[model samples]
Target: MLLITGITGHTGGYFLKELINNKYEGAIRCIVRNTSNTSSIDNSRLNIEKVVGDLDDPEFINRIMVGVHTVMHIYNIHHSPMIVQAAIENKINRAILVHTTGIYSKFKYASEGYKIIEGKISELIKNPKCPTSITILRPTMIYGDLCDRNMSKFIKMVDKLRIMPVINGGRSLIQPVNARDLGVALFTVLMSQKETTGKVYDLSGEKPIKMIDVFKIITKELNLKTIYISVPLSIGVSLARILKILTLGKIDSIERVQRMGEDRSYSHNNATIDFGYNPMSFEKGIKIEVQEYLKKNRN
Candidate 1:
């Protein structure tokens, strides 16, 4: 049996669909906190099962890990493995952890002082009897139709305002991988030979695109004429700090601006060489994603 966490999100949904489409005959279990809407989910693969429970609950971990041979950890949270300590104790092997690139790229404390998040996952992987033959996948700027958080928000904001926001001329490089491709990569890692254990793969697009060029893609996709306005990082950070204070860290326009300042360019050579993983071109993904958005919003 294979267990998938965060089965409702973009990467998880794509992984589920791909696994089902591939006619994977193994028992597939998804861990979700909410069970109120299981009617619409595809059950073509009768081996699929839904294990309901909160990610933080140890009982949920216990329920899903029973007789499970492999686990794909995509549920993003602070200290997620702590919840699944029972699985480690049970000695269930072949765990693939899907972590964020933020822990690698956007982490301020990593270079300056100590390795906090990634370091902890590494420590867990080192445990001899932990039953976690871990493969850590850190992906950069995952963008797709169901992706409403980062790049999608920028597209939506631009579409709504008929203007694009640029931070200091938007020269920072970005490597935005499609969510579907990310899903495929995860599935690949999960299903690969046991030799892939203890490997760290940095998944990224074929090439990095400039932040300004990303705005151009959104403009062309939406067929909207918009001018880019440059805002300094200092100004953006100051405003975001104020908004965080005013909205109690809920309003996030300022944080987006801060993230736009990072250089997210990454090399895909290691990922390709290790697991034969190659992400689709950004140009190709943009068209498909735009169509999906149009289809969803039209109804």
Candidate 2:
């Protein structure tokens, strides 16, 4: 049996599609929140079961972990420790956690949170009482289709404003991985469980591109004449802070502005060497996303 979480999310939704396309015959179970919409995933022909509950509940976690041989957790990192504990109790053979590459960011709060979660997973794995092999995959900024928050938001902003801000000349290098490619990477790692057990891999795009170029690609795809204005990092951060306060924390924060100025490129060599992880180029992925965004908005 295969157990999965975050099936309603972007990457998780794509992962479920990949499994259904490949005609996976295993008894698949998905844990989702009551408010999550499962319309995107086609569970018609598959032997699938849905467990609607909260991750914080121990009884709910234990109930879904029953008879699950492999657990693919793609939800929030905060609930990872609880899920890992439940998996261990259920004697699951393997657990694949989909974490973020933001853990490597210069931002203190983001990095520390991921580090703590990673630490908890490590501690559980080392426990002699628990023998479930764990594989952690840290993906770069994941963007694909209209469901994503990264490039899709950029497209929307450029479409409306026609003038987008570029901090520090937008030279910060970023490797934005497509959600479909991430789904493929997750499936590949699961199939190569024997070699990937107790491993951590960084899943990134085919190559790194400047943030300005990313915005350019989006503009080109949308056929929108958007002007990119370069701003000093310090100035942008300060303005973001003020806007955040004025908006009552509804707007972007200083930390996010700082992150925009920092390079977030990561190497996918380890994932490639282990499971043949080859993602599409940024331009191609962004084009697909732009089209999806336009189509949805047009409807």
Candidate 2 local lDDT, 32-79, one digit each (tens): 777888766544478888878989898999989889999999987788
Deviation from truth (RMSD, Å), model 2: 1.6
Q: After superposing candidate 2 on the true structure, give the runs of residues whose Cα lies further than 4 Å from its correct spot.
A: 40-42
**Candidate 2 colliding pairs, count:** 0
- CA lDDT of 38 in candidate 2? 73
What range of 10 consecutive residues in model 2 has the weakest lDDT sum?
Answer: 38-47
Residue pair clashes in candidate 1:
none
**Candidate 1 lDDT, 1-299, residue by residue in tens:** 88877777777777777776777788878776665345424555448787777767676577668888877878774545653465576677777777766655564543322246556656666766676667778778888774646677766776778655588788899898888888888877877856478787878887999888888887788788988998888887888888888998788566466777888888878779878997888888877877777677766
Q: What's the lDDT for all of these models?
A: 0.74, 0.87
TM-score of 2: 0.95
Error of 2 at 151 (Å): 0.7
